[model samples]
Target: MSADNEIVELKSHNSNFILNIFTDDYKKAIDNIKQKFERGSLLKDISVINSINAKDLNIIDIQRIKDFLKTELNIDYKEKKIIKKNTKEPKKEILKENIPKVVKADILEDDNYKTKIIKSPLRSGASVSYDGNILVIGDVNAGAELIASGSIIVLGVLRGFANAGAKGDKKAMVIANKIVATQLRIAEFIAIPPKDDKKSYSGVQMALIKEKGIEIQQVN
Candidate 1:
């Protein structure tokens, strides 16, 4: 579902799809819907919020799944709005450490400042967003998405979709310990991992958007 408060999960039966009802307020919601949308077409495709669990089914089609929301749930599919990004270097930070006698300060600054650390696995249909850099010490699972205004670093496998410098900054970079994502985006460019490399990508890899295109490289 495109609505902010609702989510749609699909069930698979060969090529056909099954509908299930799942809602916080089932009676009120279904009554309201019946009085409004279904009043026109009693047999029209309708939303059935499953009282059962959503985790037990296998979803196959994203479009058909979305259609149920529009016809049955009154959910509007909003178009993604793209915004321009700034490339100016961000402010600085100095860390001071005093161990016994000496004083130490480490400078940290970049186009976008701050770092967010994620410690859990990103499941399908879930998304994470940050204003600065991101460091995920967990897996970015398929269908999950990560969006950052600055750089992004995934210390574990990245098999989902990710967007770095989502505000339009091309200077942003993404570093990961493993690469398995179907596609990665930097600014307006997109890159897909090579099909020839099914050997389970390991080590360090980095990607950036250039005049040529999205380029992946070893982080060495």
Candidate 2:
């Protein structure tokens, strides 16, 4: 412990700390952390350890925590794990939304890939980056982002930013039920939604690199 009430050093060399939040006074805890950081007594890379009492925290609370850590403390927001005292297995809580599903498939003898599925609305200011393909079953609200090395499939509306083929795979594409995003990137090409606000379009659309430019066309 660094004399801070809620922060305790996990090790000397590591800057990470076990942020112990015992009470539901989340605002108080954040203020304490901010004060400690301003005084140069606290550092980044925090593993928020909360008591079972704090388990009832909703998505708003979780987002607030993340935002405070980033804007106030300048933390990169590494990892957040909760360990309820006396629990057999430490519950893996997914702060804003539920945990994503990972699926592995063997498409060919040398082709094995993974897919991550998100089943909740991706809120503004939230970002989801995956190494493999990404499937979102909910809306990608404005100010949110999704970046994937492989193809990105949004079963719901994609109103935010999306970057596919992040690793230079030009064949990768972004598919969405409805796309009204301000920006979309595929491989090295970037594009914005039509400025004319043309309302004529099909139910589904796909974005990909066409002739070295990002193109969005109705999906047949």
Candidate 3:
């Protein structure tokens, strides 16, 4: 299973430990915690963890885990509240009301900006190039190539080569339902998947430029 799907993952930040719980399987979680303590992997210097981040667990389950930790190992930790990202749609009327009279102006669509949508799957040896955004409705088989000046969005699996921001737009992003791509590029940066990687993913994923380089993350 992927790390994201693991029952628990322990990480340290600024010398403080944090327990990240991914599932509500109380027994499995407790077993994993026991193993960690038995192996002296996480607890060596401190008896307290900073907090527990359990987004997928309920209050009862969380309390049960906390009780188990306190009673079994005498360890104590805080429960960190999950803060969800805001995703509300912006209201146009509110925007207009807040705009200054001097700054009022018409918003015109960019005539030069375009998006290309393909309805068919890209087979091996197939090559597609678009000056603007590219959207593929089907899977991109290995050996296929896609180049776009803007962003690239694949509705199905992407196992080929994809180059976005071909004109050097560092802000461009690539998204796919399932990305097992051999290679991905955005602007001057490139990312190649590890050889013989057997990890499986369950959700949509995205690749974008980050401070360190191209970063792939599950799209929530």
Candidate 4:
């Protein structure tokens, strides 16, 4: 935990973590996370991802560095945001109970399941249930909620409520990179994300099970 610190990701079922403060010297990343909160190594949920430039450091200097990491590490301050990455994206993996190489090479490739990784940004009350497969690297904001019995990915921007398979497994699916979620489900089918007036929407969206039911496309 040096070379200017970098524990890129961790979400032990919401015990949360995602350091990575690649030096732009916000006081040398808050004194290298205050020497890893004096060697107790900042546990009990952490979040210090920074790319700076919030009008040159704002939000009361990021709440005074989350109040000095909760008074020098008694740890617990569940939220903070300031992200910006793209060195060609791709490189942020953390599915502890393993199973994600694009969900085992494309949707559980003959099912072996086991994936649950939610790093942050599931704002508005936050909720996440799982039985298998559920990966949200961030943003499910607008009233956050996600239940999964299998299949439910959101690499970002999926404005709320998601209920993939949820114990039914009707070929569960609900991918997203921006699906202004009004509501969504998979097993006992339910969805809504198409009220187009050509609002200039683009690719990378999906919602499975289709036989005149839940169907949303564009995965290219």
- Clashing pairs for model 2 are none
Tell me model 2's lDDT, rounded to 2 decimals.
0.60
After superposition, which runs of candidate 1 have C-alpha atoms over 4 Å from their true positions?
A: 1-111, 196-202
> Which window of 10 residues has the lowest lDDT sum in candidate 1?
98-107
For residue 135, model 4's alpha carbon misses the true position, in angstroms, by: 9.5
lDDT of 1 by residue, 1-220 (tens): 3244433333544433343434444443345444545454743453332222323222112222333445666543222333458666555443342211110111024533587767677889987777666667677888998887677777677888888765445777777766778678775457887643656553577787667688887643
Candidate 4 yields a Cα-based lDDT of 0.61
Judging by TM-score against the true structure, name the best candidate: 1
Task: Give a tens-digit lDDT track for model 2, residues 1-220.
Answer: 2355453223332434444444455686577667766665444444332211234343234445555665665653333233345524322323343222211121111132356778888989988887767778788998998887677878778889887765446677787767888688775467897542646555567787788588887854
C-alpha lDDT values of all predictions: 0.57, 0.60, 0.69, 0.61
TM-score of 3: 0.48
lDDT of 4 by residue, 1-220 (tens): 3453462222243433544444344565677667665565544344433222223333334344545555666543433333455445343433464333544466644233567777777888787887777888777887888877678888767888887765446677888766778688775456777543435445457788878588877665
* Candidate 4 runs further than 4 Å off: 1-105, 110-126, 135-141, 147-151, 154-157, 161-174, 177-202, 205-219
Q: Please report the TM-score between candidate 2 and the true structure.
A: 0.48
lDDT of 3 by residue, 43-97 (tens): 7555766677776665345545766776788876533334566466432322322
User: Which whole-number lDDT from 0 to 100 does residue 110 have in model 3?
Assistant: 18
Kindly report the root-mean-square deviation of model 2 from the true structure over all alpha carbons. Answer: 11.6
Residue pair clashes in candidate 1: 20-48, 20-50, 21-48, 21-49, 21-50, 22-49, 22-50
Q: TM-scores, in order shown?
A: 0.49, 0.48, 0.48, 0.24
Candidate 1 vs candidate 2, TM-score winner: 1
Off by over 4 Å in 2: 1-112, 195-202
Off by over 4 Å in 3: 1-112, 195-202
